[model samples]
Target chain A: MAFLELDQLSAFYGKAQALHNVSLSVASGEIIAIVGANGAGKSTLLDSIMGLTRVTGQIRLEEKSLIGLSAAGIVRSGVGYAPERFNLFPYMTVRDNLLVGAYTARNNVSDNIAVVHKLFPRLQERANQETSTQSGGERQMVSLGRALMTSPRLLLVDEPTIGLAPKVCNEIAVALKRMRDELGATIVITEQNANFAMTLAERLYVLESGVVKAEGTVDELRNDERLTAAYFGH
Target chain B: MLQIIVQGLLLSGLYALIAMGFTLIFSVGRVLNLAYGAYLLIGGYIYFTVSQTLGVPKVLGLLLAAMVGCLVGLLKYRLLVKPLKGNHVAVEISTLILAVVVQAGVVFIYGDSSKILLPIVPGVTQVAGASVTYNLLAATIGSWAILFALYWFVRKTHVGRAMQAVSMDTKGAAISGVDPDRINMFTWGLSGMLGATAGVFFASYTQLSPSMWVAPLIIAVAVVIVGGIGSIIGTLIVAHIIGFMEVLAVAVIAPELRGVFTMLLIIGVLVIRPQGLFGREEL
Candidate 1:
């Protein structure tokens, strides 16, 4: 069985269906990417998994169904989520933000904080500064660091590179790869930037208007002219 | 002049204590608990019944009052605040109604006549040729200590920081694994304890009656509005401003007109800087 599985999942927001019969699975320590255009239900899928949005169907993490759990319960069960909009507590300092990640796991918080600070040195330097005052890249790092503080087995990141400069995006991409390599954490990233998503993910799922249209390795999808025509209108 | 300064400082401490709880709930829950004044009324009555009537130790009375406040807070969060689901207007209206209900309850139990409370520490000390009651002094000192402890707790502790995170951003706090519900509960309980404790002191400073809740509620509201919402330091500063203004008015103008200047101050601050003297742009 896969480490994480979403079987025939469907979701909606106030009568507007956002995900329909979406089935996906991730093995242990695998890096998976979901590429799609805007309004393609990438965020909604992540929200459903995190229990921020309502969903119908099976979501099993190691055979334990997460269909009815609250967001707090889901986090306690070792799933961490970082949203596309970067939801850092703007008034809190970077260190405090990281500490909040360990809100549930309070015993080994200092150790987890140390690990996050080692991964991102800039966070340590600006630990005392309010997150609202941080740059986009730094704020993103703070968001990732906060997620890492939870010591989650499964990390769900939505659009890590949106609104970022190319250099910063590349840097974050490198950090994501390092996170997978160093922590052996499984990651599911939703991206609009297909090239960047392709570089980081071992496998890709292309979503269009709430449905999975195609799934393959990066090179396989790149070679398909029909996929490009559908995605990029080329 | 000396009396006014001394009285202002003492009164401001009580005002700060009362407003602190209200501010805390607003910061974390982003909703006003209009029933917050109910805590003060309940606390004062509980203390009066336990200590003054039943002849319990004054310290024990204060503890009983605080415990009642905490219980009320937990109940409010579980029954009222949570179920309302962040409906600010509803919460405000309901809480205001709750305060009235509590006032009526107090009247039913204790009667409408005002009751004089024996001071927690009875005596008077003359400072600069001005006599000050030891009860007021104790209340002032207690208020300062509680505020200091609260500030330290929020700034230095783990749960406190989580509360801060919740106050700043509920969704962000949740993603960080901080349960907003838990934080809200804790904040409500703390606010209850603070308000109740302040009520005990406030009742002692003046006298206890069913309508006493209204005056403190107004004072708390004025402090929050003028200080701005969700600012601890701002709350402190504004508490002093209001306290000193009332003292000055009572000394220079008329005792009956003291609340008038406070009303004007609230209007002036609201008209000039709607965000409050120290409140953030959004709150």
Candidate 2:
């Protein structure tokens, strides 16, 4: 049985349909990447799963259906989503931001933070500094660390390397891979960086204009010339 | 001169207590509960009815007043705030109307006459040629205790931290598995309790009247506007600033122009720096 599965997922913002009948499944400890251009419904798919948008579909995590749950509720049921904007508390310290993520794990806050810091040590180094003063790359780490503090079994990450340097992007990818290897977290990443996404994921879902255009192993998708031409078309 | 300092310190403590409730509602919920003043009025009347009218114990009366205030705050959230939801203007206007309506209701029952309340702890002590009532001293002590406790709770406790989280970013806090709604509800209740507690002392200091709420309400607003929104330490500091300004005006300058300086300070501060003196970081 798949650890995280989406069945015919559809979402709408006003009259505009943001996602249309999107479906995918991922087993535990697996990494999947969704690649698309801007406005290609990449972020919308992750938002739909996190219950941030008006979604109609079955999102099951470890056999439990996650439709109609609130964002807070979905998060409590071991689901995490980190967007490019990161949504960190600028007024709070890095430590407090992570604690807010571990709100459900009241007794295990310090332990969860320890695991997160081990995954990304920069967070521990800047634990006491106000998040507003941190650099963009460091804030990205904070966003990622905050998501991990929940001890999530399934994580949806949207455009984690949007404006970061290549080295930082590689670090992000490595950290995400570590999240999968160490925490046994199933990751579904959405990105516009097709090349990097291709290298990172074992499987790929190619999206265009709110629809899944192709789905296959990275090697198969990389070999398809027609899909590649259409995927990055201006 | 000595009188001004003594009066300022004592009055500032009470002012901080009053502003704390108003600040909590503004911070966590982000909507100014315009009827916040009415909480003080209602709390005062409740204490009066329980302790003075019925001749019950003062401590029990205080407790009952706080509980009633808590209930009123919760009801306001469910009935007015929750129903209106995203429309901040509607909530503010509705609460203003509710405050007026409540004042009228109080007039209907208690009459328009102001009644002097006996001190909760009667007697006075002289310090440096300045007279200090034991009642005001108790209020100051109580205010300090409440402020300390609140600071500790927000800094240390899990639920309190959730309140802090909601104040910062509601959506982020929600996604982080903190229930913004529940935390908001709790904040409203706590705000009410604090407002009511402050009300009891305020009434004893001045006198009980339906229109008595306006003064404290203005002070609460001034604390936030002058000090900055969502900063607990800022609230405390600005409460003192306003308290001393008012005291100094009455003593050194003119009693008639006491409020005039405060108005000038508001205009100057707002025109100069709108965010506040301490800025918007939550204490």
Candidate 3:
């Protein structure tokens, strides 16, 4: 069995459905990407996994059910999610933001913070600065660093490259690779940037209006005409 | 002028205590707990029952009041807040009604007439030619001490940082593995204890009556409005502003005009900067 499994998952916001009958499996230590346009249910899938939204169907982590757990409970179960909106507490200093992320794994805070600071050294330099005053790329770094502070085994990062310069995006890609290679964290990223996704992800899933349209290894998915045109910028 | 300054400082300390609990709920829980004033009412009555009627030690009575207040806060969250499902308007209206119900309950037990509480510390001293009651002085000292302690707790503690996280963004806090529900629960209880402690001092400052909750509620609202919601330093600074304004109005202007300036100040701030002096504009 895969380390994490989602079977026939359907998610809703109020009465409106955002995802329909979506299923995926993820093995340990593998990096996967879900690429889609805005409002194509990419973030919702991550939200469903994080237990941030109402869902029907099964989400199992290590064969244990995660359907009814709260978001905090899901995080405690060793999943860290960096949302697209960069939800770093605006008024809090970057250091405090990182500290709060270790709420579930309080004992390993110093070690986790050290790892995050190493991954994103800019965060350490601006540790005392409030997040509100930070630039867009810096804020994204804080979001990713804060997620790393949770010391999660499975990390879900949504739209990490959005609104960022290519240089910062490369920096993030390198950090994510280090997190996977050195820290042994299994990463699942959702991206609108298909080229960026293909660079880091071992496998790719293309989502269109809440359903997975095509999925395969990056080389195999490149052969599909529609995906090549829409996502690969053909 | 000396008397006004002295009186204003003492009064400002008490006002800071009174408004602190309300501000905490507003900031952390994102709810306007209209029944916050009822906490003071319950505290005063509880202290009166234990200390005056039952002849218990004053300190014990104060502690009992705080304990009861904490229990009431927990109950309010579990019963009223949770069931309401965070519809802030409904919670606000329900709490307002709850305050009225509590007032009626107080009237049923204590009767309509106001009661004068004996001073916690007896005697008066002249401070730079100004007459100062030892009781008010002690209350002021205690209030400042509690406020300082609270400041430390919020800034330097894990749970307090969690509270700040929840206040900023509930979803983000939860994503960080900080349970917003638990934080909200703890905040309500702590706010209750603060309110109850402030109640004892406030009642001693004035007189205990069924209608006593109204003035504090108004004062809390005024402080929150002018200072900015959810800011401790803002609350303290604005408390001093209003306290001094009231004292000056009473001493120099007319006593009847004491509250008029506070009301005008609120209106002026609202008109000039609606987000308040320190508050960030909602995103």
Candidate 4:
């Protein structure tokens, strides 16, 4: 069985359907990317896996069913999600926000915090500063740093590089790679920036209007003329 | 002037305790728990019944009242608030109705007459020429101790940090593996425990009756409104402001005017800065 599998997944916000029979799988210790436009259900797909949205689907992680689990439950089950909006508690210090992320992983809190600080050294410098006062890049670092504190086997990040400077984006890309290489974590990222996704993801899935339109290795997807024109804009 | 200062300081301490409990629920849950006053009513009556009637030790009675209040809070969250989660209006109205039901229940058992709650520590002392009871003095000291403890808890502990995170952003906290539901439940229980403890002191300070909840509810509301939402320091400061204002009005102006300035202050704050003096900016 694949490490993480979504079988015929359908999601909804109230009566409005978002994802329709979306099926996909991710291997263990691999980095995958989902690329799409605004409202193309990329974030919705991640939200479904996190149990933030109503869904009728089978989301299996490590042969265990993740359906009907709460968002916190999903995290405890070793799936960490860093949402697109970078949802750090505005009033809390950066360190406190990261500590809260380790709420379920109390046994190794100090170790995980040290790991996060190493991954994003900027977070350590601003440990006492409130997240609300941080810059966009700094806040994004805090968002990902907080998720790292969860010590998840599968880390799902949505739009990790949106509104970020090129230098900061490179820093994040390096950190994410280190997260996989050093931590042995399976990583999944959703992005609108196709180039950034291509550089980091070995395999890619194209989502459009809540359905998986295409999936392949980075090289295979890059060579397809129809896809390049429509999505990659070559 | 010394009398007013002494009286204001003592009364502010009590007000701070009363408002702190209400503020915790409001800040964390982001929902007004109108039935919050009912916790105090239940607390006062429980203390009266356990200590006064059953001849239980006063400390044990206080502890029992706190435990019962905590249970009521948990039950209210599961039965009342959870079912009506998204519809804040429904939850609020239901809480208001629950408060009335609680009042009716109290009337059924205790009858309509008000009962005097004997001082937990029975004595009187002169403090800088102002007459004070040991009961009120203990209440003030106890309130300060509890407030300091709460401050430390919110800043220092893991669960307390989770509560702060949930208060600031529920969804964010949830995604971070801090279960918002569990945090909210913990907050409700703590708020209930605090309310009940305050009630014991408040009932001793005045008299216990089915209708006593109204005055404290009004005081809590005033403190929350003037202090701004989700700020412990704001609640403490505003409670002191309201406390001193009431003392001054009663001592200098007229006894009936005690609440008049409080009302005006609320209106003035609403008109001038609706967010509150220490209100957090839109999250």
Candidate 5:
């Protein structure tokens, strides 16, 4: 069995369906990316995994199912989400934000904090600064570092590079790679920037209108003519 | 002059204490707890019953009152708040009705007659040519101690930071593994404890009556409105402003005009800058 598996997952917002019959799987400690256009249900997929939205699916994390668990319970079971909107507690200090993130972890929270700080040295410098006062790039580091504080076996991130400069985007890319390499946690990321997604992820799934339109290794997807037309609108 | 200053300081401290619980629930749950005053009423009565009737030690009575307030707060959250799912209008109406029913319950148990609470600390002391009751002085001291502790708790502790997180962004807090539900419940309980403890002091300052909840509730609403919704230090500052205004009004102007200026201040602030003197996010 795969380390993390989603079998026939569907999601709804009130009467409207957001995601339909989505299936994906990830091996232990591998990096996966979901690329899609606007309103293609990338956020809904991550929310479903985090149990923020109502979902009808089998989300098997190793041997256990994450179907009925609350968001906090999902975190306890070792799944973390970094949303597209960089939802840091704006009033709280940087260190406090990370400290709040590790509330579910019983012990060695300071150690986890130290690890995230090492990954994001900018966060360490602005440890006492309010998150809202920070720049977009620093806030992004704070949001992602906060998720890392939970020490999840699997991490899901959505659009961390939106509205950021390319240089800052590259910095985030390097940090994420270092996270996978150093932390040894499986990661699933969603992005609207197909170029950025292709560069970061080992295997890529092209999502279109809440369904997996095409999925393959980076080389296979890069060579596809349909992907260029569908994704880049060429 | 000294009388106004001394009295204003004491009364402002009590106002801050009473407003603490109300501000907390409003900040965290974003609901107006109309039954908040009932926590004070219950607190005062509980202390009366324990210390006076049962003849328990005063310290134990205060502790018991705080405990009862906490219990009532938790029950309110579980039964009233969580069930309604924080529909603001519904929670407000339900809590208002709950307050009246609780007041009636207080009347039924303790009788409609207002009771004089024996001062927690008896004897009067002369300060700055003004005769100050030890009870009011003790209340002020206790209020300061509690407020300082609460400030430290919110700024320093783990659960407190989680509360700050939830207040700022419930969804964000949850994604970070902080359960908003649990934090809301705890906040409600803490609010109750603070309200009830303040009630014990306030009851002694005035007298124990079921109707006593109204004035303090008005004060709390005023603090929340003018001081901004979520800032504790804002609450303290506005509490003093109202307290001094009332004291000065009574001393300098007609006694009946004590509440008039407070009303005017509330209207003026609401009209001009409803977000409060302090910014909204600085709690």
Candidate 6:
């Protein structure tokens, strides 16, 4: 069985349904990417998986049903999610933000802090600074570092490269790849940046208007002229 | 002159105790529990009924008061704050109504006449050639101890940091495996307990009446507004500023004009800074 599975998941925001009968699965340690245009339910999928939004369907992580769990429960069950916007607490210092990430694991907070600081040296340098004053790249580092503090097995990152420069985007993409390769974390990244997604993702799903339009290996999608035509309006 | 300084310090301690409870609820729940002052009244009356009237032990009276406060907080969160769900204006309105209701209930139980509480520890001592009651001294010392412990708890303890996380961002806190609901419940309980404790001290310092809750509520509101949200040091400093201001006004100016300065200070601070002196940032 897949390490994580979603079967026919449907979700809504108040009256309007955002996702319709979406199903997907990821094997352990797989790097899966969801590529879509804006408003394509990319965020909704991650939100549903994190239990931030209500959904009606079967979601199982390692065969443990996640339908009735709260967001905190989902996190404790080994799912780490970083939302589209870098949601670091602006008023809190970097170290405090990192400390908050380990709220569920009080015993190993120091060890986790050491691990995260090693992963991102910039975070270590600016550990005492308030998050509001950090540069965009640094803020993203703090967000990722905070997520990593949970020591997650499956990491769901939504639009990590949003509103960042190419250099910063490259930095984030490299960090994500390193996280997967080194930490053995199964990563599901949602992106509108096709070039970035194509480079790092082994498997890619194209979502459009709340439905998956295409799914394939990166090389397979790269070879399809029609797929490029559809996405870029070529 | 010495009387003003000594009284100011004693009043500041009590003010800090009162403001701490309000701060806890505001920080964790991210809303003003307009009914927070009612906890103090409930605590005071409960102590009065159990200890003074029924001849129960004073310590047990305090504990009973704290227990009542805890129940009131839990019920308020479950019945009022939870149902309202992030509607700040709604929670504020409902809690305000709840406070008035609690006050009325107190009137129904205890007659409308204000009752002077016998000092918990009766004695007097000369400080700087001024006679000071041991009751005020005990209240001040107790307030300082509680404040120090609270500050340390928030800074060092794991659960306290979780409360801070929820205060900063509810969704983010949840994502980090900190249950916001549990934190909110814990905060309300703590707030209620502190309020009740402060109420007991406040009643002994002044006198107990059904309407006693209103003045302290206003004082807490002032401290929160002037300090801003989620600032512990700011709350403490603002509490002292208000407390000392009241003491100074009573000493130099007319005693009737003490609260007037506090109101002016709030208005002036609101007009100028708005976010408060030490407020971190707008939430």
Candidate 5 local lDDT, residue B195: 93
**lDDT, candidates in the order shown:** 0.86, 0.88, 0.90, 0.90, 0.90, 0.87
The candidate, 1 or 4, that scores higher on TM-score is: 4
**Selected candidate, larger DockQ, 5 vs 6:** 5
Q: Local error of candidate 2 at B281, Å?
A: 4.6
> Local error of candidate 2 at A179, Å?
1.2
Best by DockQ: 5
Q: Model 3, range A48-119, lDDT digits (tens) per residue?
A: 999989999999998999999999999999999999998889988999999989888889999999999999
DockQ ranking, high to low: 5, 2, 4, 3, 6, 1
Clashing pairs in 3: none
TM-score of chain B of 3: 0.97
Cα misplacement distance, residue B120 of candidate 4 (Å): 1.3
Models ranked on lDDT? 4, 3, 5, 2, 6, 1
Docking outcome class, model 5: high
TM-score winner, 2 or 6: 2
DockQ of predicted candidate 6? 0.65
Q: Write one digit per residue (lDDT tens) for candidate 6, span A1-234.
A: 899999999889998989888888899999999988888899999999989887998999999998989988998898988887767777878998888888877777888788787778889988899998998888888988888888788999998898999999988888899889888999999998877888989988888777777888998887666456446654
Docking class of 1: medium
| lDDT by residue for model 2 (B1-283), tens | 8888999999899999999999998889888888999999999999999999999999999999999999899999999999998899999999999999989999999999999889999999987889999999899999999999999999777788788888888877877888888998999899999999999999999899999988888888888889877678989999999999999988888889877777788888899999888777574
Clashing pairs in 2: none
Q: Clash pairs of candidate 5?
A: none
Q: Which TM-score value belongs to model 1?
A: 0.97
lDDT by residue for model 4 (A1-234), tens: 699999999999999999999999999999999988888799999999999999997999998999999999999999888889988899889999999898889998999999998999888888999998999899888988888888899999999999999999999999999999999999999999988999999999888778788889999887666345445444
Model 1 accuracy (lDDT, Cα): 0.86
lDDT of 1 by residue, A87-198 (tens): 8888777888888888877887888788777778888988899888989988989888888888888999999999899998988888788888998889999999888998
In candidate 6, the residue pairs with backbone N, CA or C atoms under 3 Å apart (3 or more residues apart, or in different chains) clash, namely none
DockQ of each: 0.62, 0.75, 0.68, 0.71, 0.84, 0.65
B53-167 in candidate 3: lDDT tens per residue?
8999999999999999888998898899878966989999999999999999999999989999888888999988899999999989999999999998887788888899888
For model 6, the stretches where C-alpha displacement exceeds 4 angstroms are A223-234, B281-283
* Residue A62 Cα positional deviation in candidate 2, in Å, after optimal superposition: 2.4
**Residue range B1-283, candidate 4, lDDT tens digits:** 9989988999999999998888998888888888888999999999999999999999999999999999999999989998899899999899999999999999999998999999999999999999888888999999999999999899888888888888888878898898899888988899899999999999999899999888888888888888888577888889899999999999999999998899999999999999888888221
